[model samples]
Target: MESFASLFAGLGLFFIGIRYIGSHLKRMTGRRFRRAVAAATRRSGTSAIVGVVAGALTQSSNAVTFIAVGLVTAGLTEVRRAAPLVAWSNVGTAGLVLLAAMDIRLLVLFLLGLVGFAYYFDVERSARWRHVVGALLGIGLLFLGLQYIKAAAGPLRELEWMSAFLTFAGTADWLGLVIGLLGALILQSSATLTIMAVTLTGLGLLSLEQTLVLVLGSGVGSGLSVAVMAGGLSGSARQLAYFQVAVKLLGSLGVLLLFWLERDGGVPLLLAAVQALAEGTALQMALLFLVIQLAGALLSHPLQRPLLRLCASLAPPAPAEALARPRFLYDQALEDSAIALELVEREQQALLTRLPALIPADGQVAPPPAERQAVLEASQEVVAEVERFLSEVVQRSEGDEALERAMNFKSRNALLQALCETLDELMTALDTSNGSAGPPPLSVNLTEAAHALLDSLMEAGGEGEAVDPQLLRALTADRSALMERLRRDLLRNGADLDADQRNGLLAATALFERLVWLIHRYAVLLPDSLAEGISQKAPERAST
Candidate 1:
């Protein structure tokens, strides 16, 4: 009972320390880490190095994978570029496993003692150092937990039940594989399972061959866990997850085949190589874990193109992902300021075209809330990309004309972003007003007005149609007086409307009015030829 309790306690501490370390390190690195990942993708080698560093720091490949996914989703990096980072990060996770193989009992004690002193002096209270202290404490706890597990091994081996289980588990190599897989699935971390296998091997409870098979299973299990957890993701994100799954499965299974060859056919492969390189069961297991990760990297790196194709086929880019990607802006354009500014303009216009989709056209049914939100999110993503593209243009631009055009594009981009946000809020307000009870008469009118205004803006911004500044100025003219009168009348005569409906109606009208003003401002910023007379006249009318 005491041994069982110690084993469980050790497992608990091990998991807790991993969680603390991963979570705190993530918080500590935060945006800077993300930026590093985003920037590192310029070169394959740099990205790989960053990936390894990320895995080492967080001690979690899953976290690193998601971070890469997020960067891809944000248009900060391409899926192809992010693939190396995700692949190499597995190598970084081996650092902890290797550390565990060594005799670090004194080191663990010293770390725990240092953590105690830190707490005693209130180092954890400092905002900057709090995460540092927490991560250090997690390290101490992690190794201390390892020590506990190792200590309990002797007592566990003395038990008849444990002895029988170990003997049964080692009788067939495949059985150990299954055990490792299940253990990793339950723990959601292969490293944790592999470490346990390492400890058991060192204690003579399990053979080195059993530990090898178990590590292979744990590797494959880790991949399965990622695939299962990321099931809900789609598009490039899903593709990236699939890439991770491929790396793990291929690497582990490939090595497993070699192990089988060595054991059954008298072939000298990974097992022979591992035995030749390292002594002792624990050290050999750690080296094998690293070798498996390296094999995965080595095997997958050469087949990157085919693997990426496979991943894409398995999880094709969703329509929203396609929409979110910038269609016009490319890095190469940045070299030529003129081309960069032109691309920015084209991208902004593309975004401008998406604005009308926020509201359905005449006689078309309004899209469901989920569809609407997806469209809005796609537009927002493109807006972010445009902003980033323009910033780069600003830095590279040389002369006044180029600089002025970039500034003009920036201001226009800002207006477009505002318009997107207003439309989003307007949709929410309209949805609220059109409750389950049905659309109120005021809601119906507001919806129609929004549809007509968005149509006019779309036409004016379209490529084929020449910008009719006067027409836009009149269309988007101040409707404050009209909205105010409508509001007053609704309060007096809206008897059927509940409080929620009434508030929704009021908010919708206010957002619609602001929407019109934003359109007017956007028109005034149009080119001199387009805004010829209205730019001079619209501001005065808009002030009223």
Candidate 2:
């Protein structure tokens, strides 16, 4: 019972260390790392190498996978290029297991002590060193936990029940596979489970063949865990998770085939290769894990397109769901306020782009209420998410420059939210206009004003072309004059419009004027920095 307790506690500590290490590494290098990875995706070979390095640094393949998914979803990288990234991430995660398999207890301890003393004295004043310190601490804890786990397992070799279980696992490949799957699922880390298997091998409780099957099962189990987490996500995100599963599943099958061939008096190629390079049982098992992932990546390289098609076919994205998602707001960017603020600016512009779709086209009926509602709801949700993200950024930010930028971003977010509300009201008024026998005189003016504003917005968003102050002043004056004239005409010909007609026209006039004014205000407030980031081609303005 004491041994079991020690083992569980050590496992818990190890898990925490792995999580801490991955998260801190992400925080430290997320922005630069993402940009580098995005640039490297021009070819699959380079992307795979980047993936391997990123996964090793972060100590978690899932972290690397999410980064790839985020880059793909953000339009920074193509989905096709992301396949090798996912493949190489699996290879990279094997590195941690390999490192853990080695007996580097003394060196790890010495480094931990050195870092701890430096941190204690605050020797490095830079904030960046804090993350480095945290990462070293995590590494230290990880190595210490392994030591505890080994000590606990060492006693188990003398136990009767433990020996019996190992005997069963060695004899039954399926049982070993099942045990490995369950262990990995419970731990939420295949690397952790693989290290435990290596410890068992060192204890002479498991054969190399049994350990290979278990390791293969651990790979599948990691994929299963990712699949379960991605169940609710749609589009490329869910597809990326499925892609991971396919690689592991195919790799596991290949290993099984190799096992069968070896059993049939064929060349035990894997064993021979491992024996040629590695000595100890644990090192040999570690070598086998790496060989499996390497083979899997090489085998899957040519099937990238077919595998991507299969993932999409299995979990196709719903159009509605995709629209509702916050496209430009990525969690990875949150680590850097500058990048996060830029993303918020981009998302605000994206929200603005949706507005023109609601403008009623000439000779066209108002859009259906369902369509209008969908656009409105999606717009509102993204705006809300952006606001929330900005709030988080503000809370985490330091220094005058970062705080100032966050404040400006918050202001822009508020303006976008107001614009969305005003546009929704205008859409309602346009729908009401359809009920009239003929287009009201004010409706035509409102449509023209909207079109003009939409065109100005597109030009500004695309080419960094600001709406001319002179043009804005002219449009504002024209809208005010038109509103004044409509009021006098309604009074002069009071009997022409019934109570309902009068109220509707008056409401439409109010919404249209407010919408135009809001657009003008937004154009004036548009920051030059944000305008420079928009795409080069101007988007088509909605016709009215």
Could you say which candidate leads in lDDT?
A: 1
lDDT of 1 at 52: 89
lDDT values for all models? 0.84, 0.75
| Residue 537 in model 2: lDDT | 25
Best by TM-score: 1
Compose the digit string of candidate 1's lDDT tens values, residues 1-544. 8877888898889888888888898888687678778889889899999988998887778888999988888777888999999998999999989988888888888888988999999999999899999998988888878778878767767889988887887678788778778888777778878877888788887888889988898988888888888889998998898999899988898888888888889989877887898888899999999989888877888999999999999999987887888888777788999988878877777777776666866577887778777878888888887888888889989999999989888888788888888988998898888767778877877788888776666656644345575678888888899999999998899888778788888899899999999888877766647555546767877999
lDDT of 1: 0.84
lDDT of 2 by residue, 410-438 (tens): 77677677777877777666556544577
Query: Where's the lowest-lDDT run of ten residues in candidate 2?
Result: 535-544
